[model samples]
Target: MPNATTVTEVGQFLKNPPEGFTVEAFGSEYRVHCSEENLVFIDNFRSGDCDIVFQNSLGRKLKMHNLWEYTRMRKSLLSKRIYVLVSLCDQNIPESSKKEPSEPKVLQKYVLSIDGGNPRIKWQMERGLDWTISSVAGESYRVEIDLSEILESLAAAGVIAENLMKCNPIWKDSSFSLKYYSDALFDFPHWFGFSKRSFKLRLIKNT
Candidate 1:
């Protein structure tokens, strides 16, 4: 089992992302590379397993080709221990998402995940989250995201963007994990603003 590794300090990451790097997101560690730095958009949210990223943000990026490109590159990447994140979308949403779609198709923003479909791998995250919540339920931490919902949204986004500039798709994938790679950092879009992934989420008070 992999240890609970995360680069909380963005500066440290940007400064250095050793070789075998992995970012924790999508209830698991998503892939990242120092070379793809500028290409990846970074951001954070109150609720998500992405050390310090929003679950939704990661979810949306699941619809992009850059992500798949990463998939195609998986073998060349961490070929030693690989678990590619692949999504077999059902293009037909069956019915328009009752979820009122996402923010908007900026023809830009949309972008973001499942790690390995393995249930055990999921528990790894659950345990980590459990410990996080128990240790700091009142303090701070990221939360699990509804992947099912995001995928539904992506299937509706139409095909993905092969050419980055071709269509922009939704937006961009928010960089979240890794450390054993080289020199990368936790960054966010200045335009969108950043929030602590540990910030306590405003839970709905049960009436």
Candidate 2:
């Protein structure tokens, strides 16, 4: 069971997670942390069928067939909204065949390199983090977050293409507004952008 204080601490830790924390879900002590890979896994796990696990410093394993259940449980214990940030590395293009005719290729490196050029970064925020803490749970809680807000925060963080910036170096202040992107440019393609950037936000929850 997690408490309000524990929830806050976990969120903070994720914002600036300690170094050397691998994405493995097992073989670790009981502490809360997150990584880009882990977040992606969780997101996909919730939307589809999959399993996830985490290990604590003590090298104990915690397995969950469905992360949505645990995510809800965490929210139930919190009094404030919890923000989730996910960063990914951009992929590099593969070498093409010189002699034989081949189909056009796309890179799959996914690792972003700043040395090449400044890559646009994207971030997402979960607008409202709602949860419930029941005394009967003996300290455990459940959590629910609006996915819409998460997508908004990510777009707000600048998920637009790098080439677009070349044409117009500056973007309108409202360019990031959720309504604008959700309605105006909902079908815009996200390309030639960096992914390894960091994102942070507070969890705002009501009483």
Candidate 3:
């Protein structure tokens, strides 16, 4: 049996997740750190999936078959929330994409956060990290997320576009995501977003 655990250390959680563990969604680069619970999904990525075209990583591509196995494996634990705590890595102004009007070149790369325009960049980082706590239970045939964690820019332009279509507060908030275009955007974050986003889907069809 795979050891079911509640891991704290990222290293322990991921068996040597390669540096630059980044993904793209909404035409932006997002670094994702996933802490899994009763889900052995990552290990299933055998360093790469050649069959999955247009994928960035060498790990095997995840398919509906994998979801079936994940569901089957967790049926006994439906009483417990089988979930993951996924954290997106932050980027500083310098590390941010240059496709936009990147300013303050005086500062060293990564010297400031991507939200260099925000007066409260430091404070915002503490309280405004883009994170999602996704959990699924037997009662609901879908994933559930905390609404407060919705990233407006990401949801509108890329992932979860429909749910956040009405969001407008982002325009006023200087701390809103830069939402720049980048070549790094790929399958990873899109999958991560859906895996965590609250949505309904039929995993099985009734005969």
Q: Cα deviation in Å at residue 112, candidate 2?
A: 16
lDDT of 1: 0.30
Estimate the TM-score for candidate 2.
0.22
lDDT of 3 by residue, 19-108 (tens): 333233332223344322222222222112211111222121223223344454334123222222222222334445667874332111
Poorest 10 consecutive residues by lDDT, candidate 3: 107-116
The global C-alpha lDDT for each of the candidates, from Candidate 1 onward, is 0.30, 0.25, 0.26
Tell me the alpha-carbon RMSD of every candidate: 20.2, 16.8, 18.3
* Poorest lDDT segment (10 consecutive residues) of candidate 1: 198-207
Ranking by lDDT: 1, 3, 2
Best by TM-score: 3
For residues 1-207, write the lDDT of model 2, one tens digit per residue.
221111112223433444334333333322344332222112211101223222321111122224454454233223222223222222222355546655333211011111101111111222222112122112222222223333333334464344432332221111111110112232222122211122223222320
lDDT of 1 by residue, 5-115 (tens): 111223234234444344443454443442331123234432224343422222322221233333343322222222112223222232466456543322322322222
lDDT of 2 at 206: 24
Where is model 3 more than 4 Å wrong at Cα?
Answer: 1-7, 12-37, 43-62, 65-87, 100-197, 200-207
Pick the lDDT winner: 1
